[model samples]
Target: MTESDHRAKLFGTDGIRGIANMEPMTVETCVRLGRSAAHVFKDGTHRHRILIGKDTRLSGYMLENALVAGICSMGVDVLLVGPLPTPGIAYVTRSLRADAGIVISASHNSYQDNGIKFFSRDGFKLGDDTEHEIEQLTFTGRIDDIRPTASEVGKATRIDDAGARYIEHVKRSFPNGMTLEGMKIVVDCAHGAAYKVGPWVFKELGAQTINIGVEPNGRNINVGVGSLHPEVAA
Candidate 1:
C-alpha cells in the first residue's frame, strides 16, 4: 500500500542490489525489471515516459542497454542521462514530468557492485506492492507478452546536458556571500561518476585544486578512494 511497504517486500533497505553481473544486478534481471516497470505505469491518459540515470560503473553500459530494451518493449519511452549522480536523476525525473524514474548505481560500492533504484512520478520511491508486482512479473516470464504497437514503440534518447544542468543548479547552492578566491583544495573523485565534474566545481569556485583518483579503469572505482575510503586521500 505504501512505498515503504513495497520496498520492504521487493527491494532491500535500499533498492534491488547485488554484485555486478550477478544475481539481481544481472543483465537478464535488469531487462525483466524494466519491462515490469513499464507495464505497471501503462496508462491511456498520457504517453508513458521513464527517465533512467546511472553512476559510472563498468557494467553500467551493459545494464543500461538491457533496461532500455526491456522497457521499450512495453511501449515506455526512455530518456537516458548517462553517468549522472544519483540525485541528478531524481531532480530530472520530476522536472521532466516522466511517468517514472530509474537509477543504476551501487552508491559508494566498489566498481564490481551495482544496484537498481526506482522513483515515482512525484519524485518519490515506489511502494512494496508495486515493487513486488514488478518482480513477480519479471520472474513469471510475463514480460515478453506485453508488446507495444508500431505507433506505441518506445524511443530511447540521450540527455546530453544533464551534467551541465546539474552543475548550474548546484552552483546556486553556495552561500551568496561565499567565495573561494584563495583556497587550495585537493579533490579525490574516486574515479567514479564525478571524475570530471568534481574537480571542475573546485576550479570554478576559484580554488587552486589538485585532483586525484579521477581516472576510472572500470576496475578502480572505490578501490582505494572515494567517500568510503577517505584514507586514500591522505
Candidate 2:
C-alpha cells in the first residue's frame, strides 16, 4: 500500500511530529497539513488569518515555508511570527482573532527533530474532531481542487510585534505591585523558541537574569543547556 493507501493517524493528541525532513515530518506533509487546516477553519465574509511560529531549528525554516505555502493556497492569510515559544503563538492567535495558530517545534526534542501543533482562536489546542478532519482533507487531497486563485489567495506577512506582545502578556501574570527586583535567576531557554522572550520576560519583571541557551545557532537547541539539560545551566 502507498503512504496514503494505508495511512494511519497523522495527528496525535498534540500534533504531528517526527524527525525533521523525515517521513512524517517532511515538507510535503506540512504543506498538506496547512492546506487541510485552512480548509477546515476558514469562515465568514472577511479574509481569514492564521498565526504561525517556530523554534530555533534549521528545519524550522523549511517547514515554516511549506506551511505558509499551503495555508496561503487556500486563500487564508498567514501571520508569520518567527522564533517564538509555542505559547507565544497561541496568545497572538487569540489576541489577533486569528482563525488558528501553528507552532513549529519538537518541544524537548533534539535539533534534528521537529513537529507541528495547532491552537484554536481561543488559545487552546484544536479538538480531536477538528484535527481528524484536517487529517482527512490532507490525506484525501480534497482541498487540492478547491485552492483559491489570484488576489483571493492568502498572503503571508511577518508580525514584527509578535514577540513584544507575548512578553507583555507574560509580564501581566506577575502581581501589579510585585517585581523580580533583587532576585538573581538563571533561565534556560533550551536554545529553542523561548530563547529571546524567556529571559526578556524575567528582565522586564525586574529580575537580574542570567539567561542561558539564549543563543541558538539552530543546531544547539536542547543540546546541553536547556530545560532538558538542566545541569548545563548550573
Candidate 3:
C-alpha cells in the first residue's frame, strides 16, 4: 500500500499533525505537501506566492525549510513570517496578497507535536475539498513531473514587519477610543505563537501586564505554562 493507502487520513480536522520529525511531520512529507499545495494554488502565469508562519517549536525550523524547498522547487514564491500566531499568518497572507498561507503549529499540544494548516487568499482556512485535493496530489506523485527551473523557480522572502503589522491589525479591533490604561492583565503566552505579541499588545494598549511563559526556549512551549496552566499567571 502507498503512504496514503496505509494511512487512512493524512490531514485531521486541523491539518496534518503528528510527533515532530515522525512520519507525517517528517521533512520528506513536508516537501511533498509544499509541492502539492503549490500546484493546487497555482493560477496561471502570474507569479504565485504562499505565506508561512509558525510558533516557537524547534521542529518548526526543520519543517519550514522543507516546505520552502518544496514550494520553491515548484515555482511558488514564499513569504515567511517567522514565529507568529496562526491567525497572524492568515492576516499577513491577505495583507500581502499571497495566493495562500500556511501555519506550522499544533495549538495547545505539547512541544513534541507539530501540525501544518493552510489558508486561502481571503485569509480563511482551506475547506475540506481543497485540502483533500492537496492531500491526493501529495501522495499520488502527479505533480512530480511539473517542475520549474531558472527564473521560473520560486523564491523565499522574509517579512520582517509581519509582527508589527499584526499588532496594528489587532489593535484596530479594540474600541476606537478605548485604552487599557487602568487594567492589570496577566499575560501567559504558553511560549507558543503569541509569546511576543500577547504581552506587547496589552502593554502597548496601556495595560499593566504581568507576563509569564514569554520566554520560549522552543522546547518549553506549553510546558507547565501558557493556557494549559493558567495558574502560572493567576
Of the candidates shown, which would achieve the greatest TM-score relative to the real structure? 3
What are the lDDT scores of the predictions, listed in order? 0.81, 0.88, 0.91
lDDT of 3 by residue, 119-171 (tens): 99999988988998898888886888998899999999998999999999999
Question: Each candidate's root-mean-square deviation in Å?
Answer: 4.0, 1.4, 1.2
By the lDDT metric, which is better: model 2 or model 3?
Answer: 3
After superposition, which runs of candidate 2 have C-alpha atoms over 4 Å from their true positions? 4-6
Please write out the lDDT profile of model 2 over residues 1-234, one tens digit for every residue: 366642565787678888898867888888888898898988888889999999999999999999999999889999999999888898999988898999999998888989899999898998988887887888895667986788999999998999999999999988899988999999988788888899989998989988888889989988877766778767
Instruction: Provide the lowest-lDDT 10-residue window in model 1.
Output: 1-10
Candidate 1 off by > 4 Å = 1-10, 141-144
Task: Evaluate model 2: give its lDDT.
Answer: 0.88
Looking at model 3, the pairs that clash are: 190-226
How many pairs collide in each candidate, listed in order? Answer: 5, 0, 1
Badly placed stretches (over 4 Å) of model 3 are none
